[model samples]
Target: MKRVVFNQKGGVGKTSITCNLAAISAARGLRTLVVDLDVQGNTTHYLVGEIDADAFPAEAQGAAGLFKQTVGSRKMHQNPDSFVWETPWENLFLLPSSPVLTQLERELESRYKIYKLRDALQKLDAEYDRVYIDTPPNFNFYSKSALIAADTVLVPFDCDSFARQSLYSLMDNIAELQEDHNPDLAVEGIVINQFNSQARLPGELVAELEAEGYPVCATYLSASVKMRESHHEHRPLVDLAPSHKLTQQFLALYDELESGRA
Candidate 1:
């Protein structure tokens, strides 16, 4: 399955969810790949740690290179696998992001290469058991590409009134994209992240969403300091603390997604 974790709002845990969920899949012995399209490269850093500038590929070798190579080319010469990098973890791979992506958006859009991402991912579908894409915080070229390429999208919702309002707009954008670009795209569900069960406001806000008939995931990931620690160490929750409460919740969420309960 190919899933994109996205939100048009920052600080909503998109990178965390992407890396951790993909990590769990790898831990289960599935071949997993993470395509980091965010210019910030948070997911890339989370999976592989700080990059060595001396050994890093040029702007023409990462995801930016993939998009750049597609421009005005009658055929794809570079294999997509060449752009992929191996992570420290087993069965996990990364198509790392680059600062060059910030400059290629307008060029790609003017060249009408929106469907190129979908085509490339289709070529990789046979080789990977699961593919997860981490996108930026807006409906820009990269996010749109991810949406078009993915079979499903998992939205992250932080319990707040403003986030709830933004969710409406995000849903509308996804619906429009689905109609125009990928009719097969499915909204897996809204994942309630950083949920504070101790606070009455969090529960009330979630209940309101449920009352409004939103498809919210059954598992709520409670806010934890361990997630911050995991980030600092560049380790997924399952790898950092398998027996921790938050890690168990992540496992449960993964199971729910796998079982089609979300």
Candidate 2:
């Protein structure tokens, strides 16, 4: 399955949720590939430590290279796997993001190359057991491409009033994309990240979402300092602190998603 973890609002833990879940998928022995479409490259940094630009050329780097190949050509003849880089963990691979994506976006959009990502992923269907995409905070060219390419989408909702308000607009955008682009793209669930159980507002907000029939996930990821440490260490929760409560919650969330798929 190709799953895109997306949210228009920043600081919602999209990178954290994407990388950790993918790490868990890899741990379970699934051949997992993470495609980072965000220019911020947080997911890339989380999976593989700070990339030395001197060693890897921007044009030939992960998603940038893939998209660059489509600007002039009518079809992508290059092997999609060529853009993928293996992570430190077994069964996990990454198509690292680059700052170059910001430069390539306008050109790609003008050329109507929105479907190129989907095309490339279609060619990679047999090579990977699971694919997870981390999109930028906004709905732009890259995010749209991910949405078009993904089989399902997971929205990361940080428990906040602003995030709650943004959720409505985000849902509308997804619904519009479904009608205009990939009808098969399903909203898998809304993952409540950085949830504060002690806060009454958070509980009330979640209850309201549930009552309104939004697909709020059963599992909630708590606010923790371990996640920051994990990021600093460039290790996913599964690999960094498997026994921690936050890690266990991530495991539960991963299982919830897998069971839903089954």
Candidate 3:
């Protein structure tokens, strides 16, 4: 599965979802690769421990390549795996990212290179069993590329009124992508994150989303100290606290996604 965990809205747990899903998928013995397309490099940070800024046409081995339109298809396809890093987990790998991707976007946007990533991934999708893309906070070239390359998409939404509006807008964008670029890409479901059921507002918002017919993912990731600490330690929540309540929730969610697939 080529899955993109995306949302235009920031602070909605996109990286957390991407990382956890990748880790779980890899742990299941499926060769999983995470493509960090976010300029924030949070995914890259958590996975690779650091981002290398200086790999030119060559991506610093499993490091995220800045979308290079001029790089031949042969070359572009070779780089993602070249930058693929070995993680603490057995089967998980990462294509790390850096701040340079921000500038790469500006350069490509002018050339109308909207589907650069999709074009690149097509040449190499056969190599990995699962590909998870961690997109940037806003809808930009990377976001478009993720949507285009995805076989499945997931949106991690927060519990807030403004995020609700952004969620609708994101769905509209996905619809457009489905119509024009990727017809087969399925939107798996919505993962509600940073949720505090004890709080009235978060619970209320989850209710609203469910009532509105949103496919709320079975797992609700809570705002937990361990979740935050795991990122700083450069590991997954499951690795950091396998028995943690939130970690168990994510594990169960992973099982559902794995089994529920048609």
Candidate 4:
């Protein structure tokens, strides 16, 4: 399955959900590939740490490279697997992001290379048991490409009024894109992240969303300081603290997501 974790609003745990969910899949012995399309490269750093400048791949090596090569080329010269970098975790791999992605955006859009990402990922599908894409916080070329490329979309939503408003706009965008670009793409559900059960507003907002017919995941991820530590240490909760409450929540969230697939 190819799933993309996306949200137009930032700080809603896009990278956290993408990396941790993909990490959990890897831990289950599934050969998973993470495609980081965010220009910030937060997902890349979270999974692979700092990139060695001297050893970084050339212009056609990472996700940026893959997109750049599609500019005028009629055929893909480099195999999708060639750009994959193995993460520290077993069964997990990465198509690291690059700052150059920002530079390539306008040019890629002008050339109508939106379909290239979908094509490249199709080639990779046979090699990977599961593929997860992390997109930037907007409906840009990269994010659009990810949406079109993915078989399913998992939207990360932080329980707040502002996020709720953004979620409406985001849903509209996804609906339009599904009609115009990927007819088969599915909105898996809205992943409620950083939920605070102690806060009345959070519960009220979630109830409101559900009342409006949004597919909210049953498993709500609680807000925790351990998440910050996991980010600082560059380890997913599944591997960093298997016995922690937050870790169990992540595992349960993974199970919830998998059950949906069934």
lDDT for each residue of candidate 2 in 1-262, tens digit (9 for 90 to 100) = 9999999999999999999999999999999999999999999999999999999998888999999988875656679899999999999999999999999999999999999999999999999999999999999999999999999999999989999999999999999999999999989999999999998999999999999999999999998899999999999977899899999999999999999941
Task: Name the better of 3 and 4 by lDDT.
Answer: 4
Ranking of all predicted structures according to lDDT, beginning with the best and ending with the worst: 2, 1, 4, 3
The lDDT leader among the candidates is 2
Q: Cα lDDT for residue 247, model 1?
A: 92
Error of 4 at 116 (Å): 0.7
lDDT of 3 at 7: 93
lDDT for 203 in candidate 2 is 93
Candidate 4 stretches greater than 4 Å from native: 73-76
Q: What TM-score, over all chains together, does every model reach?
A: 0.97, 0.98, 0.89, 0.97
Per-residue accuracy of model 3 over 12-63 as CA lDDT, tens digit each: 8999989987888888898888898887889878876754345434333333
Candidate 4, 29-50: lDDT as tens digits: 9999999999899998898888
Candidate 2 lDDT score at position 165: 98
In candidate 1, residue 81 scores what lDDT?
A: 76
Candidate 3: which stretches are off by over 4 Å? Answer: 52-66, 69-79
Q: Which candidate gets the maximum TM-score versus the true structure?
A: 2
